[model samples]
Target chain A: MQCFSCGFNAMPGSTSCGRCGANLSLAKAPIPVTPPRAGAVAKRILPGWWALNRRMAPLLLRIGIGEAALPALAVPLEVVVRPLIAMVQRPVSLLPGVPFIVAGHRAPGWLLLAVWIAVMLLALMLHGLPVIFLLLVGGAIALHAASALQATGLAYRSVGARLAGIVTCAVMLLGLFYLPLGWGTMRIVGGGWWVVPVRVPASFPPFAEGDIIWLDRSAKPNLGDVVVTFRPQTLRRVRALAGQEVAMIDGVLLVDDVPSPWQSALRPLAEGVRFTVPDGRCFVLLPESYPPGGTPPAPTPQPTGGWPYNRQPMWTVVVGEREIRDAGGNWLPSLGSIEGRIVGRSYPLSRFGRIE
Target chain B: MPEDEDPQPRRAAAAATAPAEKDAAHWLRLADEQRRAGSHESALRFYSRSLEVDRTAVTGWLGQVQMLVQLGEYPQADVWAKKALEIFPQHAEILSAGGQAKCRMGALPEALVMSDGALARPGESAYRWLVRGEIILAQRERGDDHCFDKALILDRDWLVPLEAATACLFHNAPAKALKRAQEAVERGPTSPRCWFVQGECQQRLGMDSAALKSFSRVLELSPQHLEARGRVTAGGGGGMWRRLGRLFGGR
Candidate 1:
């Protein structure tokens, strides 16, 4: 295709020029699928009452009727509209010394409570009335309004105005009933009136309810520092620090030739494993995967040596030490079995995942 | 005589190889220098050169994206960020930068979704939380307050929350704004912009003394803080002049 803006030759179907990088598509006039009507084309548009009313009709109807029906609608129009209003309102309301706290006036607590009580009482009263009585009352009101409209012909003259008024009243009532509850529920769900910052200590264990963790890393971490580290695959603990010589001798952990205290907990695998922890690396293990103080099944005996090393059960050696237990009462790995130190607990506890 | 012939060939081979190595080192140094000097445009060029020399230079791509963001060219930055992500999708810095660029372009919801993907990965820095807070602030939706609170809870030292708290103040909660600004200042004492936010929060709360102190700190750190200076004047009263003198070292 030829580039419309730069007039440069481009490969067929290209949207932009390869040389000047001009957008060829934008330079071309947009092709209309349907032509304008003769009447629409001939009219001279004026920027006065007619234009204003035409432009505002949709907005007024949307605000009056569409918004009124919004509470009962499937989608949350409030969520979509509120932000747009706020975005427009911000720049216009930019006055110095005017505290931003006045953006939206929250109804007073007592007023809200009173409204709630009134609504509840009204709901109770309505519920107490027989359904047939409510139906009759509703039917009588409708009959009266229809008769009055038909007799006066005023409703016919101002059908749009009457509809607008009815919609406005309905929306106002729905908003009054739903908004307070919605706001209150939102506040409650968004975590109450006060927000306090909690510092998650680096070594804070994986999320358990009521565990306070310091999330800052202002201080330098030291050896044996219990730090919070997030892991994706599994929840585990760091057994060694960076630059420390970490070796697993038959699954017994050794830090710089000194058997770490955690090694005794992993005695089950001590016979056949020995690996050195490389520099800048830390040893990690999972939290005890088995039940605490439970013994593991004995390893099946195998020939001493074979072409491929025979797999042996190491659970028997590490069974009784501090370990997590499965439902079946088996010993599990501890924090030292993991790869990194705890750094920060992911927030909203719901988002918290196992540290792998 | 054979030795002379061998030296000539050896010299010719060395001459051919030296220019390539020199070119590589020259581009590497130029990229680093541009980055340090805050000339992101030049840095991007140098980084692209470095990448041309060695496609495996992951740092070059990362540097290019970082520079693009610093230059405030988000569209180009976004492209580079995507490239980096393609190479190492789980890379924390790439994820954080990409998420931030998306935020600057007013694509907040998309930015937040990207941030969640980053947070899902193992091992992230406070920068990720900072970016998340920015996106949440831009959204200004009802649940955004919770996101800001969560971001602050995740990284107490992050400055992003202070800015977000200022936004919260604009959204109708001065008390919350003050609380958030205080936490941010406490966490990052050296940031003059943080102190300015604190001053704004304090002024909103009607704590004139505290507000003056905050503005004074802002001036101490950033001498040419015109807005802060104007605020001090706007908050005029008897003790204010003395405080300004003390702040400006007149005493």
Candidate 2:
């Protein structure tokens, strides 16, 4: 055995180099190389694809190792990258003593984290080109390893510390590229997709339980858009668009003088509600029975006041299907209350398609 | 002492010292003393004895009703209020007590009627306004705030505001309850109910740290306040106290 520190050889049975007093066992032995079989020399040079596969085989293996190790490496990357996203969202004003930028619309702190995690998962799932990038990354890592081996003459002990700096930089670069590309794709294919596990067979025909839906958050909801709403969050079909006059007379909805087909299906409570869909406000007609999943009725405390005012427990309207007013007697949800429109269903292999 | 030097106060005063004073007023005075001394059970017993001596003793009737409400015996409170109302149909305080009981029992319409009748009567006190607030809250009316405001304005002490704050918290109007709780705390800084109400308001408003502090203050003021103790434990701040208690051989 040879001493890593002094390059002095020790007797075969010895633990340490006697002259240098160094631990000889710590030095790594050179890996043995196997000679090619004699029959292989008789063969002609391989075809292009065969040669290509040969080159790709080792690269693919290294790429697989990198992809497997990525999630572990991305943790430290998150801590460094998050603050940069925050800084971009709120630029530091150069004014004296001002630390953060003032912006009208600030993205939520969790938004970048969620986007990054999703993109990383997407990168892991994607193949072909990312593998090539990983191959280059593997080479870079090997070069670093070789440099460390020449200096220390042993394998690097601090795997995380040694590679994290380089890996994090690579990840940040890839993240910067991936985020915009993902965002553009999201924008084109509607912001995101969702699964509607609740099956409302009676009201939402053709759509059943556990159906996947696509959401285009940026798209303007129309009169017939089956939109997803936030606030008193719900999924409902839009019946009244902005600038349209809406009236709920005895639980019947009249949108711009046309009695909606939903009116006949719904049993609105006895309340005279009339309003013009104000600017940027649209009326979404929800299903009569809530929990859209057709679940059993959840016990809800009755709205105090009188028994007459107590309607069925629901997100908005408690009165009969015709009633457009909420438990507080507030009108139907406004457009500002909506999150996005359900562009289409994207799951359940058999019924996979767009939503009207 | 009674607010006025009227016949009732004179009778009460005479009853306190007179060797032969064996009347409803004497028992009522003893009940008030017990209540002031924090012996609610004995106070209730004295009030019952007073009411038995003289069923028409309006003060004794109101005292029994108030005690029942305080003890969370709403059904008993309702029965007592109804019995008191049969004798004193037009009494403002009795009507207010009835309204409070009815409101707590979920009889909103009847409670509203009683509260309205009480408010319509002249010489309205803070209790009547507080009852009105409870009734309005039960009715889910927007005028509940105005009712609480009136109670606070009429109350010379912090009791009305503290009770109203509790009622507001019960009705899920924590923002409005917070205002009343703050007023109660300002007026009576050491009152456990005020701190409890403040804690409840802060908890509902998502100010968990402030709520934990408020609940801790409540337990500090009244160590036997189980609700405050529950809030403290629920907020995950009671571990230190428990460990200290264990060190001191306390359960």
Candidate 3:
């Protein structure tokens, strides 16, 4: 006889379920009566689920594979995505120690929970795109396999009644999430690595739209290397280093009168301009416009959507070197303003590696 | 989700669903429907919904645990089963469910103990017998036929034999599974699922032509059966079924 409680089968006249150990006699009480669901919500909404799992999933199982095609696809949504969706409807604090609390010192799960809260506050504040952006990033880093008990240090919110929509939540969460954010940014800064989601002008080479810049702050800027400068705050390729003669002769870049690669898509000078790049200063120029799908991408590790949330810097400079035209026409930025050189992993699809 | 929150976290009421519409029995029906329809995830959510409406509903709790196991979330299933037991201690079904999880996790001895414990409980049922049979089969042993036979005797449903056949097949006993599959076919000759089971068992036993015929019969019953269609088209079947396969799959 088949055990109704848990689908176990046993010998004829067996008193109890051999698999689940339920008494065989009363087994029928709990079995959900299998009614033909004609026009039922399940049948209407998920015909494929019904057809496949009822048919395909069992076949796959008997063939030594796994369960439902829909369920297999839905696993990620159930484990990772749904909790995040539930967090939004969270009339309560859904992410106590969900994302951040890490191993002993810190954890990625706890931080992600904090990120989610921060994003919601932004949503309440009506900062629409940013909220969507942050949520997408948060949703992508789901913690279905997260270790729970290690996050005991996350009970720091005993003070208030915790009520707010996306805006007030955003403001409050900014301070809350930014507590760890400030520390994390500082940590990365001290560790000689700087990561930032950067957007640049269409004329800028290498950096793609929505590209993240990972800089090796400790590395010295070299010729043909793309580096970030703080003085004018732009990503520029180093054409002429200290004491190197740079001349925009007949619209050609000449480093010490040798034909250098014309890296900029902008017109920095009209006449045959020549100047000695002063010591401790490098002549910088925004690299040539990188055409989308023109060159084969460099096989870099970090894909487009990576570990999100870093200190953002506004990309105000459309053409930084041209702005220096009035001030003696020298586009040299001091070495101290040069924060760091862009690593190979910076927004890989474009021409970051090509600049060298 | 227990992945992050307490073992039995307070589920927030869904914003889109009106409170008046949140009937536990209705949700339970929907959960069962979804499970039958094949989306364990949907069923899992429905069970959660039912529990949200009425946490005391043991069926909802069991459904949640069963769906998790179906989705291969054995660890989560085990955890949920333990939580269920805390509320309804000595629940035969819950014990069997837990045993199923332990069996899946490769803990045969623990599973056998849990199964035995379940039988010692008062709620005698065929499901617990099937659970026992499953645990026995999982142990790579051959003495599970009696356990399955007891389940078949208790439930007399064609699905029981098919389920037993599947359990036997999964446990590497194709010959035994084939017998069970034949019994299932005898009980429910028109069911595409039974024919499909027979076909699979035939394939496992290396009865290639007979397996093809069984798959062909499945196609004739359920014209939309994709796997059977593939088998039919791949020279798995001949005669009238092949012509039917050409008629359906020609385009």
Best candidate, TM-score:
3
lDDT of each: 0.49, 0.57, 0.60
Candidate 3 lDDT, B1-251, residue by residue in tens: 44766543243444445555668888988887676444678988888878666665779878887776666666457768876775556688888988876665554555677899889987567778888988767655566888988988888778778777866765557888999999989998988878987887876665768988998999888899888888767655444555465467420
What TM value does the first chain of each candidate achieve? 0.28, 0.36, 0.43
Off by over 4 Å in 1: A1-356, B1-77, B141-177, B202-210, B221-227, B234-251
Model 3 spans > 4 angstroms off: A1-97, A100-356, B1-54, B237-251
Docking class of 2: incorrect
Judged by DockQ cut-offs, is candidate 3 incorrect, acceptable, medium or high? incorrect
List the candidates ranked by lDDT, beginning with the highest: 3, 2, 1
Tell me the lDDT of candidate 3.
0.60
Please give the TM-score that candidate 1 achieves against the real structure. 0.28
Judging by lDDT, tell me the better candidate of 2 and 3.
Answer: 3
- By lDDT, the best candidate is 3
Error of 3 at A118 (Å): 16
Q: What is the TM-score of chain B alone in each candidate?
A: 0.52, 0.73, 0.75
Question: Against the true structure, what is model 3's DockQ?
Answer: 0.01
**Rank order by DockQ, top first?**
3, 1, 2
DockQ, each predicted model:
0.01, 0.00, 0.01
lDDT of 2 by residue, A1-356 (tens): 65443455767878666764544443333311111111221112212222232233334435565233433333232223322333233332211112211221224323433443454433322222346437544543343333222222222235653465445434533454345656766566453343222222222333444444556676677767777666655567676777888675645567776666544233243356666766666666543333212342443342233354455433333343344434311235666666677766544446656766
